[model samples]
Target: MSTFKQGRYSRYLKPFSYLVDLSIINGAIFFFEINITNTYLFSLYISALWIIISFKNDFYEVQRYTKIVQVMTLILRQIGFFALILYTFIGVFKQPNISRLALGEYLLLVFLLVAFFKFFIFYLLNRYRAAFGGNLRNVVVIGDTEKSRQLINLFKKRLDFGYKFRKQFIIENDDFSLQKCFSYIAENKIDEIYASIAELSNKQINKLIDFADNNLKELKFIPDNKDIYAKKLKYEYYEYIPIISLRDIPLQVPINKFLKRLFDILLSLAVIVFLLSWLTPLLAILIRLESKGPIFFKQTRNGFNYSEFDCYKFRSMTPNKDAHLNQATKGDQRITILGKFIRKTSIDELPQFFNVLFGDMSVVGPRPHMVRHTNLYAEKVDKFMVRHFVKPGITGLAQVSGFRGEVETDKDIINRVKYDIFYIENWSLLLDIKITVQTFINAVKGDDKAY
Candidate 1:
């Protein structure tokens, strides 16, 4: 059998693994005397969540060389998220007849069954490869870049990955050309091609891609500046042409995006109705009495995709044209009596619930920066623009972690952006809730900054 055909056996491992484990879950559910009638919906929800989490986590990727412990840990995380989301849904909807007995036993069984089968299957595959090189893929490296050379070396070192290089085509060589690479592939059993795509023109890349497709070969590319990019980017295949647009921003995923928007709407509406309804009027009175400017401060800030929107605050400072240009500092005379109280307590940001309601912001995200700051930071920091991929927030990971208030030095902005990027990349509903709770706790205790 061909190497590609032999290796295709692992492609079904993911779905097959999930299905077997899901059966175990259902069996455990039945044995626990849980009400399966009503909880059928719950079962379906669990299956759906499994697929989503798997896709997001690359759980289906057939990495035969992956450690058993790593696989177990990945499944553990997947199961944990699955459990949390299921229970949260049940609690939110107030679903009845869910026995802790059934859920606990089922989850435990799932983890055990999944880990057992994953280990067993991978073990069998390894043994098979040891006995016969049935799953090995013949590949070629077509680039002179250090990155491509390193990749070839890695393949040579990690023999268990089943990658055998037929030829290493160095573009810098005098005789190296596309025709030469193709001729070599035609003569050898080449299963895949890894080229340093940064060195290839669009035409060359496209031709190589078509050549791979026509000849049933896999074409992979290595960028010259691989270190400058994140590894977790999503590869989108458009009409059989692979285009890596950007890193995997989970917020941009359809389901995650929808759910977050739903959460923002629900929470923002509640805050606006309950907190801001009464609080806004009361703060307006205090501001009018203490200051000469408008009760609400509206400033243009860069939000999702660097679009400028009016970020609402409770007029925390005396209105100045330089509000857009300057960062507030401690004991600044521009801040009135009410401004100081509100800013310190984060009450000045209360009106931003309105921004959330209007879909201008999220309750939890990277805090939007002033247009001036956005431009400045984009220049100073690499990948700083990535923060704008998601909607800005009134309270963020940076703010809750005490990275808020005045930007005094380069380190301050650097740490803030670092935290912001971390939040964007690692976003989850649970993380958002944790950050929200942290923000509340910090507000009660107050921060040294926020002047």
Candidate 2:
């Protein structure tokens, strides 16, 4: 219906809705006019202003998948704009025809009436669509990606959104080409073309755009932010050049970032001042009693963005050349008596609180990978490197979820990467708090793979 009508019937709803709004406002003014005896002309002018404002803001644009909140916001913003213009006009011209209290009531009544009408029409429209109305637009999604798949699923789940998927063309599939894409659309009454812009080649994108334009089809592109972990993306023109802007990730939002960092610092400071301050000395004595090495072991590991940072831990093994290269096994004899006990109890990781204080790590995030392991896994696993997009932590969702310990199999690291990415994508204060509590619980209960 989008391509066939060019939004014909849907477009008419705008003028119709606007006309209803004018009638309500005029009626309100006519009833409430006590001091203002000649409100007919004033009502007409105000109605015109309302219509003009609604048109300017594209309030009547028919969007099948639009949320109800978006509709409410549009109406409220339009009213705000109208109120400002009306007040300025009256103030500057010194129009003393209106009764302030009556005029206020009139405006309030106008708002209420219009709001009721708009929502009532909205309910009718939703019901109309739900009955498999003819306004449904047939769309073909091109590209197999998280965004593309999600779009397809949303359309399927929401029949009231008035979208029907004709076909899905995956560029990476066994048989997919521009010719095949054209043929697929030719067979169906496709109204809109949705493509994953990042995955499509420039020539392919241009062809799709040109086809949509010539055929009067709507063309929409889904952005790729999985790699950059962009929470929000905005497309706008900067002078003549088109630009894509990446908004702040949830954790990096100004207030959230400040609070999270402040919390990390204070908690780390408290632990160092009280717990670690005394416990470190006792652990040092035990560590040094068995091994002829420093009590605290510091080794460089991959942190946020794969940056190397000195991760501190109590010495849990005899100093070895493969400190960062080799993974600690079940019982390889590199561990001393005291070292095994501390490693199992996870007391050896207490020194990393200083790393959190030093801003090298977070209290909760994907566990920092050894530098060698990071390079080794980056090439083998898909989206494995995405874990580096955030700060590494001493314990993480992956750790507490039992994806911890040595990566003995490919599946081990795969599951770990999945959880790590999930954490990165859905990070919140509550999520961090939950993970921290779980980590504490797991430490006390003891994980079999820890040693």
Candidate 3:
């Protein structure tokens, strides 16, 4: 299927999903005999919340690559949010007439009904597409060799990926003419085209762009070796190196990005006020007692768009610890006894709430690397600087997934970069919450690599 067609299908499906939710909500209210002065107002608010959260969660983006577990988890989160909103309103308003049993029954019925409708619709759509002659995307390849064949095999193996391979056109060298290629693409009604960038000439590149511009069809090219950086292409980490391809960032979507930032700001402020305010002073005194140095350590680190900013951390090492750059090793001499405990508990990173407040960082994102380390790793690791596309975070997907502490080996940095890229590509508010919850759990358990 062409990208345009697939997008149109998603648009069509969204309204049906909305109507289904509306029906379920209304049915639940009727079945539970819930009587309130502003019942429709309440229903509208709840239904709107579900739709907004669903969009933020990308629930309507069901595709061949969409995982069942991801969809189910999103549904659960949406339902949980609805429950929280409903209960909070009820409690605050002191609505004694609203029966507790009715509310419980209403929430339960809506949850089950909505889940069933969504799953059944998706299942039927998949079955119908398989059973009948459905609109399958016709894709063509520009290069006829190994890389092209590998891409073909991937699509064939994953039939649910919504791609239908049509044919391959071989372009031998940089001198290959694109005039013929454009003619062939137009005649074939190709929905999408993939080419190897290394094999294409300047003329051919321009032709492909012109073709996409004229035909309103999608044109994606695979890098010869994933070495080039293009903001237009989505990059995924294979350990430390990035696998670049034409894809959109999840965070770039307006609604999802907005909700994510809002969550970050609100959550960061709450932590700063309720938790970090008092804890910072106490930890500052402890650090001062242990070492004759500044209570807080400030260092220049890369933030969003590779912008440099001063990131704060509770001082965890003795005075005169090398500021240039050094990865703290196992039993490092510079790490004081008090430093070890705070680092293990991740308490040292709490001061970054100010970074969050100052808009230099997010509550969750790719962890920032030291300026020296960034310069070093960019040479050692391919696509190392891609993490700077987003603001650095105090805790990130990498940290939660056990990539924290000293990155002593090439492999360690690679793994961390991979997780960080994955986080950026698939970012959502729920993902941030999940990472935060996991970070808390990991802190309590205490990993050997923490200090």
lDDT of 2 by residue, 1-451 (tens): 0122234347577658867877787777668754654456566678777766775666665356557887798778877787676665466556776567776776677778877898888877777877846578888989888777888887777777777777889899877897778767756767667788878898997777555533445576776653453445545321222224332246644345556777788878988999998998888887888879988888888776456889999999998988878888889688889988888888889889999999999888889878778777766776676676678988899998888888899999999999987888778888888888888788898889889
Best by TM-score: 1
lDDT of 3 at 255: 78
lDDT of each: 0.74, 0.74, 0.74
lDDT, candidate 3, 1-451, per-residue tens = 1111122334467667778787787667777666666777777777777667777666666654456676688778878887887777676666678877788888898889888887887677655555563546678878765666778776666455566787777776565567666676667767777877778777877767655633445677766576456566665432232334454667756476667677778888998999998998898788888779899889988676556789998888886648647867898889899999988988888889888878888888988888788767765765565676567888899988878888888889999989988998888788899998988898898977898
For model 2, give the RMSD to the true fold.
18.5
How close to the true structure is residue 186 of candidate 2, measured as C-alpha lDDT? 55
Q: What would the per-residue lDDT of candidate 1 be over residues 1-451, giving only the tens digit for each residue? A: 1111112335466557768866765655665655445667767777777777776765655465566667777778877887787667557657676666666777777778777776787777777665676578788888777667777776776566677767888877888789888878867767668887777888988778656533445566776654555667545331223324333567866558767888888988998889998998998888888778899888889887566799988897877878878878888888888888898899989889889989889999989888888777776765566676689998899988878988888888889988988998889988888998899888888888867
Model 3 local distance difference test score: 0.74
Return the lDDT, model 2, position 63: 58
